[model samples]
Target: MTSRAAQEEGVQFGLADTGNSIPVGLVTGIAAAALAAGAALVWWMRRRRTTRG
Candidate 1:
């Protein structure tokens, strides 16, 4: 009985850890995508202005 409880607790902890990892991964991915998009927008604006001028 105690063994089963311990096993259950371990599984719960593992699942929690996995769940935490997913959010961190998602946040990092989002930040990277935002940075890339911002850089692209800046580049496009600069190119357009230079071409016009």
Candidate 2:
């Protein structure tokens, strides 16, 4: 019974790891785009605030 439990646990762990495998390139691209967009938005907001004030 213990052996069967261990086998089931291992299979579940393996699948969990593989199921979450995201490509590094895609992750990096997403991060870069988000950063650029955030920076641009902040810059625009500050510019507008300064102009109005």
Candidate 3:
């Protein structure tokens, strides 16, 4: 049963007509790249330390 206020306001709780898929995809891609870069930097630093020691 829907509330009277909801019925009057006509609020839609569903998918957007024009989705924000592109921005979401870009944000996820950038995050993955940042994580990968961080991992690579750590590996490089560890390798350098071992070689120096």
Candidate 4:
């Protein structure tokens, strides 16, 4: 770990544990939406297969 001054001087890169830039709320919403979409697609595929058979 280096001081902020050193980082600013471009002596080190990505060596610090800088906090996440993305908001937790936004991440949670995106994950939830993806899960719901995936579930709906799976359900639709199963229904279509059953009807055709």
Q: Judged by lDDT, which candidate is best?
A: 4
Instruction: Put down candidate 4 lDDT per residue, 1-53, tens digits, no spaces.
Output: 46788878877665576558979999899999999999999999999999999
RMSD of each: 6.6, 3.4, 4.2, 4.2
**Candidates, ranked, lDDT:** 4, 3, 2, 1
Q: Give the lDDT of residue 9 in candidate 1.
A: 79
Per-residue lDDT of 27 in model 3: 83
Deviating ranges (above 4 Å) for candidate 2: 1-5, 8-15, 18-20
Per-model CA lDDT versus the true structure = 0.82, 0.83, 0.87, 0.88
TM-score of 4: 0.64
After aligning candidate 3 to the native by TM-score, how far in Å is the CA of 12 from where it should be?
16
> Which lDDT tens digits does candidate 1 get at residues 2-50?
7679788774433433455467878899999999999999999999999
Q: What is the lDDT of candidate 4?
A: 0.88
- Model 3 Cα lDDT, one tens digit per residue, 1-53: 47667778997666778865569878889999999999999999999999999
Worst 10 residues of 4 by lDDT: 10-19
Distance (Å) between predicted and true CA of 36, model 4?
0.2
> Candidate 1 — which residues are off by over 4 angstroms?
1-22
The runs of at least 3 residues in candidate 4 whose Cα sits more than 4 Å from the true structure, single-residue gaps closed, are: 1-19
Off by over 4 Å in 3: 1-22
If scored against the real structure, what TM-score would every candidate get? 0.58, 0.65, 0.58, 0.64
In Å, residue 39's CA in model 3 sits off its true spot by 0.3
